[model samples]
Target chain A: MIKKILILSIVLSTFMVAKTPKEIYEKNCVECHATLPSSLEKMFMSYIKTYSGERDTKIAIKTFLKKPDLDTSVMSEVFLDKFGVKKPTKLNDKELDSAIEYYFNQYKIKGRLN
Target chain B: MLVSRSKDINLFRQSEKVSLIRFLVLYTILVASLLLLISIFYYQSQEKLMYAQYTKLLNTYANSQIKKLKNLHHYFPQQTRYPRSTKFKSAIYDSEESRIFSLLEKEPQYFDNKIYRTDGKIHLVHTLDTYYLGAKYLIIEVDEDRTWLENTLKYILILGAIAFVILSIFGVFFVKLFLKPMRDAILLLDDFIKDTTHELNTPISAILNNIEMIDTSQMSEKNKKRLTRIDIASKSVSLLYQDLTYFALGHKMQKKDEEIDIKALILNRMEYFFAIGNSKNIEFILNLEEVYLFIDKAKITRVIDNLVSNAIKYNKRNGTITIDLTPMGFSVKDSGIGIPKDKIESMFDRYSRFNNTEGGFGIGLHLVKSIVVEYGFAIKVQSSLDVGTQIYVDFRSKGYTL
Candidate 1:
């Protein structure tokens, strides 16, 4: 009876530990983009505004998130001097896409609702 | 010192009996380790190659698209048919050259193409690499399906696994087949030892019997002495025959463990040895305790015949041979050229001999030892080099009950 109970507990623990795709995204990158809602137009606008003067935003963001780099951040020297350089968020491609869409809808076009 | 070939040959790390098993186990481990190492290397290198190929194909698509896009701008700069072109599922056009194109071939909707916002639509584009040139990025408006490189890697791994398993099974079978001849040779050698011991009984009997029938009364004194020596040679042959027979065929002998009068059995064996003893001028001093033992008469006869013949053959001329039989056991002592100190231990070993002068194949004491051992009796031999030799056979105390 004790052996059966132990085996059941082990199997239950594994299921509990398993993460869904949404949870994986939330844990890895939700800190930065969790407040944003999902929208493709808003996402594109947010990307433009976020890296206003950046040379290569798509390639830079993809490479940077996979392997972070402070030297390539699109934030201006004046913004970084005030806020201190924002840390680049780490995420898998799938999770990053979800977060990216969320940021676009929330910050980029939140004013367009009116 | 005995030189053993088994000790000298250290080709393998174990004895002959277990060498093949050990070799099989080692070979299995080696093959498994090699397979594991190769699989790991192949997995790592193949994964890298696949990724590189994917990147290369994607790059090829991007480069070809850029080349065509440049040519189109050169030829028809104002053509709004760019979006309708089949080169890209969805394409964004910049005023000068900036464009993001998505390939239509993908299983699930994941990626999108977008031209970044810049001052006056500055035509800045980036190229990517992939394993398949036909498909790179997918467009949201177009849906296509064909992933060739991923399917290729999957097939390669599956086929490699099947080939490895089949080859490993064949290797195990071949190893077993290769070891079969050596195993058969050892079995044949054991059979040869048994057969050779069985073939020695016939001629040995004929020689001993002819010597017994010799009459020395008509011969001269020198000839009579030679006859006596011949008699000793014959008894030695008889002893050897008894030992070999006891070793090979003793176990199959019928046993009748009746109450045997030990004194009478000793006296009968003494009579058998008298002819050889007479030729040697050896005197017999019988000291019988009239004891009884429980044993088969035929086996007891073999044991007594071997011991008495030994005493007579090694006895000096005119020497006294004594036989003392009791419930405890029997003892035969002779004043003759006694066994060498070094040879006493091996006296019970088959074909172990100390004296070259005495005619003996050296199987007598070996036979005596075997009979005593079979009946749970103990025999001890004691000798002084020039004095005499004494052999004592002690049947265990339980022999008295029967």
Candidate 2:
């Protein structure tokens, strides 16, 4: 239809070209969390999967990232001592949502194992 | 005279009505618009606030449900469906929108943070994490009554009404206060006019009466000519004086309407203005008819005096001033300099004289118009430049009883 072409042409003309959530995660987040992709996602999902639901898990991760300290960390004291605590992220809300979505899609154990 | 003065007051009131209407319309619209906008914003914020409270309530219920599910999972691992909340109906779904556990049978239409209504119930959908046992979406449905919304709107309506009443009172007071200066000026002008006319009454009567008492036949022809000039000049001033006196005492003027003979009254008024016409050698052609009219004598006389004198004043030298009267109406036709078409419309306005060469204040026709209107009659002036003018007065207006 004419509508589809017009929309496509507008997209091309504007050239907004936003990065995908995965690409955004790799670009801004992976360097600090892990040298390899999916490493942080694996560790976070193992702890988060025990929560009441996906919303609770997403909220917990988001809250922890906002102000990371020993009290809020889900990791064992041994792991926390070895890896160190996570500092506040420089990423804004949009980037954070993208990165979190990328983490969920990449390494939630149910999705990866199934 | 009272009729003439009332017309002036009517004119003043009419002029102010426009400004009053403009102020009221703009003021009310502006106020209403502001109140409406505020109402919209308040209602929006109220919606958010109420929902926030509902979300907090739902969140508490959600946490309790989560804890119950955790214990149920720990002990009853073989259980298939998650437990439901007793406070409200609830359901859970997987990522594919397939219901994993639900209390209600029918599924919701949309999944968003805001509440939606369906099947006579209100519900809100929330996404929960920690996937305690694999559920992605948790929906909370409660039977919501509209009494709260109605109460909110009722409060808004009351607020709007209060603002409208308060603003309207202030608006009227402010508008009137703003026009106070203009009202005072008009009142002061009216007072000055009454005092001036009151003072001119005695002197004008004295001049007219003494001039009448003079024995003109005993004087030399040359002095007689001078006396004739004085006589015409004095008569003109006396006519103006009568008009002003009637105008000043309009409110105090007595009204005594009775059956009067129109034929005699017309002839008498003709005789009254004969000398003024004679000064210019203007001839009178009378077509008087015997007609009875129920009217005040003084007001009708003023009307006739004005029309006849105007014909004489504006007539050419040795021209004819024709007076025609029927049972229905009368007309004063003159062989004189005619009025321009543009000037005729405003000729009935006080002091709106178009013909400046004539010696009189322009109050005559305006006074005549007032009396005509009062008596339910119609008058029209037809004129063309350099040809002539005809002033017609019909006894009855269209749809008038008499």
Candidate 3:
């Protein structure tokens, strides 16, 4: 009876803890982007920092994700032909705001690559 | 002699009441219709604005998620589909419009509009530029919560009801204010008629009484004929005076409802009207039944008097008049100059005479119609050009139909 109750508690808690946006980012975004401070995602953010302001860069990231095609393409044509454009998003307002905030903080180049 | 037409002062207040109700009904319809039209237009614009705001919010949410998907696919070259979102339900479709994977149980019914609504929920289907996870159509569904709209509609209806009541009250006040002049004019007419009727009563009685008392035993036969002519003319004037008197003071007079001997009343009216018909060389054929009616005596007498007067005044020389009274009702058929078919309906309008050939005030039938309506009696007039006229009054009333 005790073991059954313990199992039930674990199941209930699992349902109770709805994934936060930061958690969602780590699970969904970090698999290919990697967790290091020198991933390709970080490199792209550094390049975006050179030409775009902080809010513009963040907004650009969101706009490109929403509609990725030849017209809004940042990658070369060769790469575009190989990988194609990204699909549309399914995040609600609460989840999307949290995810964007996570992306802004994670890949931001605050220090030198020494 | 009576100075003017047979205009009843007692009916002035009744006419005012009728006009007051008419003005109120017409004014209310105009105000309410305008208010309702404006409200409907406002509600439609408000609905459009609300939907636009909702769509903008959904687009912002979708755009953020798309960014996250792009980041995931950039570094990971072998990725197919990203992790599913837990916050809201959505579905994705390929370029062929086939569903890839959805949090929904089934595919959506249509993809025609950028925004679609289904049972108590809003659905936004946005086209994607790129095929991340091989998706072309991105659909997001949210539960509809329109308590604000419902509240707005409720407020509008409440305000409309209050406005309607307030406007109606003001309308009545203004209509009454506007009709004050008309009422004063009618009052002046009544006062004049009353004064004239009072002054003429003494002279009329004097002329009639002294004529009755004059010694005609030793008078010349030619002078006797002249006196007889005067008597006939005076009696005709007396009938007109009596009709006017009843119109003026009849309401003030006490009325008692009793079982009236209708046959006796007809016989007396015929004898009294004998001089009138004889003067015109018109003949009266009365087929009166011994029917007893339970009503006011003065009103019945006025009705019969008006019908007989009309028959005599409008008749040709040596023409015939047929008055038939049965258990059902009575009819006055005249063998005289006929009324036009189109003018028959206008016979009951006060001072409405088709031809001015005869001397009359034209209020006889108007008074008849008023009494018939009061008792819920059905009246019909049938006439043809150059043929004759017949007026039928059906006394069997269920109630006032109008």
Q: Which candidate is the best by TM-score?
A: 2
Reference-based TM-score of each model = 0.41, 0.63, 0.61
| TM-score ranking of the models | 2, 3, 1
Q: Give the winner by TM-score: 1 or 2.
A: 2
Docking quality tier of candidate 3? incorrect
Q: Let me know the DockQ for model 3.
A: 0.02
- lDDT-wise, the better of 1 and 2 is 2
DockQ of each: 0.02, 0.11, 0.02
Which of the two, 2 or 3, has more DockQ? 2
lDDT by residue (tens digit), candidate 3, A1-32? 99999999999997688888778777755664
lDDT of 1 by residue, B36-77 (tens): 677667766755564455445444445666555444333332
What ranking of all candidate models by lDDT puts the best one first? 2, 3, 1
What TM value does the first chain of each candidate achieve? 0.41, 0.69, 0.64
**DockQ versus reference, model 1:** 0.02
